[model samples]
Structure formats: C-alpha cells, structure tokens
Target: MFGIRPSQKVLLLWSTPVDAEELQAMVGELKSVVGAEGKVAVENVEMLADSSHAGSHFDLILAGVLPPFQFENSLNVLGEALRILKPGGSLIVRTTDSATTQSTLKLTGFTSVSQPEDASLTDEQKRDIISPVSEITCLKPNFEVGSSMKLSFAKAPAKPSANTWNINLTDDDVDLEDPDDLLTEEDLIRPDPTTLKVCGTTGKRKACKNCSCGLKEELDAEDEKRVEENKKNFKSSCGNCYLGDAFRCASCPYMGMPAFKPGEKVKLAESTLQDTS
Candidate 1:
C-alpha cells in the first residue's frame, strides 16, 4: 500500500485505461488518505513520460495500479517521475518485471531502489483483483538538482604566538641616527652665488656671439652645475619614470631611458651629451 499522508501531493500513473468505476474508486481511496488539504492526480505512463510537469511538485508517485500495467519506455517514464518529484520524494512502482524495473529506476537516478515484501491484504480486497505484482520503491536524492554548498577541506589558520616580534615599538626604543646627522661637513657648506658669473668682457649675464675671453667655457661650466643640481633635486611627479620610457609621461625628463630603481642616479650616454640639433 502507498503511504498517502495528509496534506501531501500524489501522482497516480497507469499504463492502460481502466473501468471508470474502478478508477474513481482508487482515486477516492487515495483522496480519503490525503484529506482535503492534499491533492491527487492521474495520468497514463506514456502521457506522463511526454508531458511537462513542474519540478519538485509531488511528494509521492504510484505507478502500475488500478489496472495491470507494463512500461513501454521505462527509462523516460521513470526519468520524468524523478524530475517532477520533490527532493527526498518517494516513488512506488508495481511491475511484472521486478529486476528490469529496479535496474531502470537506478539508471534513471533514483536512490534507495528496492523491492519490499508483499503486504498482507484482506480477503475481500484480494478477491477484487488478481495479478502477479512486483512492488519497487525508490526516493529522489535528499538534495535538489543544481544546488551546491561550499566545502572547506583545508585546516583552520593557526593563531599568532604571544612572543611575536613587535613592529610598533617607539623610535626611542632603538638607537637610530637622525637623517641630518648623516650629512658631512661639505654638505653643510653652501656655495657662494657670486662665483656663478659670466665672462667680464660683455658685462652681461649671457655669453658673447664671438668671444676670446673664455666666456663660453665659463658659461658651459655654470650650465653643467645647474644640470647637476636639477638632477639631485629631481622628484617624479608621475611616479612611473623608474619603470622606463613605456610607463613615463610625455613630459618626463627620464624618457627614452632604461628602467632604474627609485632614488638611483641616471647618467646620459656620451653621444646624447653632444648637441646634434
């Protein structure tokens, strides 16, 4: 007997047409067990196999009853039943071929496929119908199809030890030298501005067009000093000059130069030092 509980949804699958009276009687019996809060539906095996039923709709399904039944496409019928049954739903099948039915149920992805011992029936009920019935029961898996859960297989992270080194120690806790203390006596001395003068011939701050008083060399030396000073004080605005010309800005002074570490001094090639333009 199928366990038709109250408030449960059930499907009755038949392979062949039965007498209207017998069909109604079977449905009535099922309805009585399910009560008013429950539902009961009937369909032919062939139709059930082809019809589109909502997924996880039924709590139980009973096949091959009310009339002697045999599956035409056992796989498709069982598969459709599995598809529409709720997670952990039960399926009870009565077939003439028990071995094939059990095998087909397992192949259709039903779990716990088994044949139960024949149930004792009343004399009046046994006399009403006569057939060699093989009863097989199975259940849909407990978890719904396409559902997933994350699993952590790795061990938990270890806690830090109490004796771990303290990086937050105050500056006074360590013997550290001041940055200014690292400077030498020469670094402290400032250069006199008067020494950066042009040749006295022109009495101007620029070189003469044609000069024989060593004005050009003096001007060149001053230019070189200014270039050195600029190099020493240079700070990257884009912060990508150290990554090479590809990463440098259009106005970057380090364009066309090879990649170098930050704070590194860059030297121009001798060819580049010459005025080609």
Candidate 2:
C-alpha cells in the first residue's frame, strides 16, 4: 500500500517458513522495484515473527507474503515491522482475501499508499489490487503488535462493535441520564440542523482524511468559542478581515479552501486547526 522509491527501504517477511530461492527473488525485486537503487532486506519467521526476535528494522514492511492462499498474519507482521518504520514510511502487506484491519492505523499515524494506474491492466485486475484482503473490508483498530492476544484467548480484549461509536462524531438521540457515558448514533438524533449544532469536532468525530476521534467536536467547540472571542476582539476589524461565525458559518477544518493554493493570509490548510494563540 505504499510507493517504493529509490531512497526508501523495503522489508519482506515470511511466516510458516520459506525457501531460500523465493526469499532471494523477493529481496531482488524489492530492491529493484524503483530502478534497483533502494535497499532490500529479507527475513523468514514464524508466528509473531515481528517481535524483538526478528531483529530487523524496516521502512516498507511486507508480511504474510506467500501466494494463492497468501499470508495469514500479514496484518500482525506488518504491524510488527511498523514499529521500526520511519514516520512517513510505508508497509505493503499481502494477505488472503479475508483480512480486516481497523482504520486506527490512520488515526494514530499511518497512510495507505495506492498503486499507480496502468493502462495495460484490466478493470477487474485493478479492482483486485484495491480490494481489502479480509472480511470484505472488515477491519479493527490495531493497538500494538507482539502484544495482541488471539481472539480465542479469553484475555483478548473485546473491540468496539460496528457503529457503537460513529466516526462522524454525530448522535441521533443522546440520553441525558449519563453525560459521561459514551453514546452511539442510534442513541442520538438530529433534532434540527441548527439545534443539532452540526459541529465537526467532539466525541468520536473524525473527518474523511483523518480518523482522529473526538477531535472534531472538541476542536469545533474550542474554535467556535475562539471565533466568538476573535469577533469580540476585532469586532470592528472588518477592513482587515471578515470572519462571520468562524466555526459554524465558514469553511470547516474538514472542508478546506476551495483551492489549496498557498496565500499570504496564513490560513491553515484543510483538516488543520487554527492557532489559538
């Protein structure tokens, strides 16, 4: 799920054991994917191979990489290698057609890289490349590698059920009984557009680009408050700038500038919060 460049590093891991020749080929192409200028490292390990035992640092990590049946623990292994990856580095994993992982990776810090389009490939082939390998896009938030207990284990923590927490930071009907208790979309409803305070930040509010939970409502509330303060401070600065309700009436942090073109006004880019200072 990442673009390999001449300056990047690629790591390939094999679980359930692997042959030497296949390992060699993987190493070769991985190094040569972008003009044979990048570094390639190969390792063959068993279950939980990404632990300290694997003893390798990688940038772009590939795991559970066998074909046909593909890799079983690709998700787990890729996570293991991710510990060593640079902030902007990537991990391209291969798994069966039934893998599912949480978008938490994006929330915490991980970006999926898309493959470049090729005219020679058929539409079906393209679709296959983009399809999620597990449970038809079923995924869960990954906490940490090596520490993940199997689902069969009684000690394994239960994950969030689907829609139990809406990523959109919205509620249909909130119970006033428990202000601290987390509510679900079904629990809350929109009384009206204005009454709803259609904020972009708060509990579990995430945008399209980032899955940062609860940030939207919190940020929106803070910004709304701040915008009010700014308006009061510069109530008559209409000549310098025009800010109607900075939080509700204008472009949201999620809804960025119509054009990303930089300007001299020092406006925050899309998906960014204003400097409260």
What lDDT tens digits, residue by residue, belong to model 1 across residues 50-103? 677899999999887555445543787778888899999999876667778778
Q: What is the lDDT of residue 91 in candidate 1?
A: 90
Q: How does each model score on TM-score? A: 0.51, 0.33
Query: Which regions of candidate 2 are displaced past 4 Å?
Result: 17-19, 34-37, 45-57, 72-78, 97-277
lDDT of 2 by residue, 124-225 (tens): 434545533421111222443345555764576788888696555346654356764678876787565434433355423234346354545666688789
Score residue 185 of candidate 2 by CA lDDT: 77
Q: After superposition, how far is residue 50 of candidate 2 from its true place, in Å?
A: 6.8
Residue 201 miss distance in model 2 (angstroms): 44
Q: Which candidate achieves the best lDDT against the true structure? A: 1
**What is the lDDT, from 0 to 100, of the residue 68 in candidate 2?**
27
lDDT for model 1 comes to 0.78
